[model samples]
Target: MGQTIIEKILSSHSGQEARAGDIVVAELDYVMGQDGTAPLAIRAFADLGGKDVFDRERVAFVIDHSAPSPNEGVSALHKLMREFSREKGFKLYDIGEGVCHQLLPESGEVGPGSLVIGADSHTCTYGALNAFSTGVGSTDLAGGLISGKMWFKVPGTIKFVCNGVLPPGVYSKDLILYLIGRVTADGATYMAVEFTGEAIGALSQEARFTISNMAIEMGAKAGLMEADDKTFAWLRRFTSRKFTPVTADPDAVYTRVLECDAAKLEPQVARPHRVDNVVPVSGAAGKPVQQAVIGTCTNGRLEDLRIAAGILGGRKIHRDVRLIVAPSSRRVFLDAMAEGIIQTLVEAGAVMVTPGCGPCVGTHNGVPSDGETVISTANRNFKGRMGNSNAEIYLASPATVAASAVTGKITDPREFI
Candidate 1:
């Protein structure tokens, strides 16, 4: 009879009691779109005969995917977004600012118990802050912009109870990949996943973001987590907003429950063509690689960079392999520079690029050649995900990618650690 986290958040926003499968119109605290989706959303707003947005301060646009205008066509779209933001007096993040998911939390547009919707599937990333966030189509995003509210059918919750301590060489990425492999890509379709227990609670806020960012990969609507002192501390560092943390009732209903032991997990990799086609590092070890990428919206935080630098400090990558490093945001880039993490990576034969969603989206940089293999820290690994169906992608933790970069093959991070 108790409400889960998603139900409670939706109820608060809708001004009524909400239950799974109930349709309600909930007020939105924030809405966002990036270059990849903003053009369509802007056009949709005009098509809807929308005038000024409901709130200029609550709507934002970020130009990150295919940043710096990969081609004249993308440049024109960026120009349109810029003009629209200027005309509407809405906030706009220009090139190299960061991915929308990373920038939103950094700018404090998201907080616990807030309702957020974005034009990007990874908008679910904000759920790490304990918000009820999900992705909407361009038309839905336009409606939310014009009216400051959107409708939702409350989703049933799937509880993932992870216990025990993570091993030294393992991390949140490995744990998430392992979970995805178990559940398969469509296992949690249209449902909300609530990650809990000691292992998840022990992770850093950034790590939690990585987990939430990938929820959509498993066909989840949103990923929710409980807030504690660590969550508040992380929020305080960005904004002074007061947030009321939400927790599920002890007897909240769940569609299914999965219990995992973190101590039993090892580094995991999702082979090409499908994210769910995952295997342990040893299962795919020694496979040759032509490129290795160490950043994305999922694992491009400062902690991720430090993990890579720790392995490549006094070493150089394989001569046959190309290592690409991209910081997630300008702040992360500058902080890494101040701490010499950037220098360590570059001196170790890594090529540093601007902070944005470059290689991950296959928009502009680091596109592999035909018949080549790449190991990356990005979330997805479908065919042609990196701009070429002929080039294969292997998804792994940053440590695994860095270690593989050094050896020109798929190598286990535990060996390097």
Candidate 2:
């Protein structure tokens, strides 16, 4: 009769006992929408005759997907979002502010035990903070904006207990990719994946973000972790918000439990057109690459930049490879500059773009050419994901992408490490 983390959080918000498959109307702590979807939500809100948002403080809009106005049509949408935010007093994150997922956590808007809804599928990224966050459509976002509450069918939890220390050159990204490959893309549809065990605990908060951000690829409703000292430490640097971390009871029922060992795991790569078509680095080595990207919502943090810089230091990227670095946030950009990480990457032949979802969503920047092969630290490898259906994308960890950039092929990071 024990409740899982999602069940417990829903129970608190709904003021009733919650269980798997139970529909409950729960209060939301925060809600967000980004450029790709917010415009629709804004229009939908008007369609619903929405005059004032339930709370300005709890709602946020970010312009990151097609930042700096990729085209006139997008520019007009940006204007609409700006005009609305200005009139309604909701927070608007302009160009260079960062992706919604990164900005919310950095500004302390997200915390443990909070129920959050975002209009972006990758909104599950906040689950690293021990919160239950999920994505919704534009219409649903409009509803939450007006009422500050949403109904949910509590999802069953799937516990993934990772064990052992991650081997050299292998990281949290590799572990998650390996899992997704085994479980397939649609394996965990509508389920909450609770990550636990020794290897997961050994990961940094940034690494955990990379893991949780990709949970949607596996069809997970949310990817969650238990808050510990590392989570609290990261929160302290951002906000003074008081949060009581939520954890599943010892006897909480799980739909399934998977045990994984990362002791001998090598770097993983999800091949083109499908995130589940993954293989070890050795299987895809020497595949020519025209471009390599080191930043996105999944791997654009400071730690990822430093790892790329460390690998590229004292060397230049291959003549055939174009490496792009997109910082996730302005804060991360400024901090990296102060530490000379930016300079090192630029000097090593990496091109730096604005801090946003550059090249990931294929809205504008860093789009690959026809027949081009790109190795990126992005979450998905679906065809046309980077603006061209002809170009192929291979997903890997930051280290793997950096090393591959140096050699102009799919190379393992362990060689440089």
Per-prediction RMSD in angstroms? Answer: 0.7, 0.7
lDDT string for model 2 (242-285, tens) is 99999999999999999999897999999999999999999999
Clashing pairs in 1: none
TM-score against native, each model = 0.99, 0.99
Q: Model 2: what TM-score?
A: 0.99
lDDT of 1 by residue, 1-417 (tens): 999999999999999999999999999999999998999999999999999999999999999888888799999999999999999999999998888888999988789998999999988988889998999899999999999999999999999999997899899999999999999999889999999989989999988998999999999999999988888998998999899999999989999999999989999999987889999999999999999999889999999999999999999999999999888999999999999999999999999887888698888789899999999999999999889989999999999999999999999999888
Clashes of each: 0, 0
- With candidate 2 superimposed using the best TM-score fit, by how many Å does residue 2's alpha carbon deviate from the native? 0.5
How many clashing pairs does model 1 include? 0
Query: Positional deviation of 305 in candidate 2, in angstroms?
Result: 0.4
lDDT (0-100) at residue 364 of candidate 2?
79
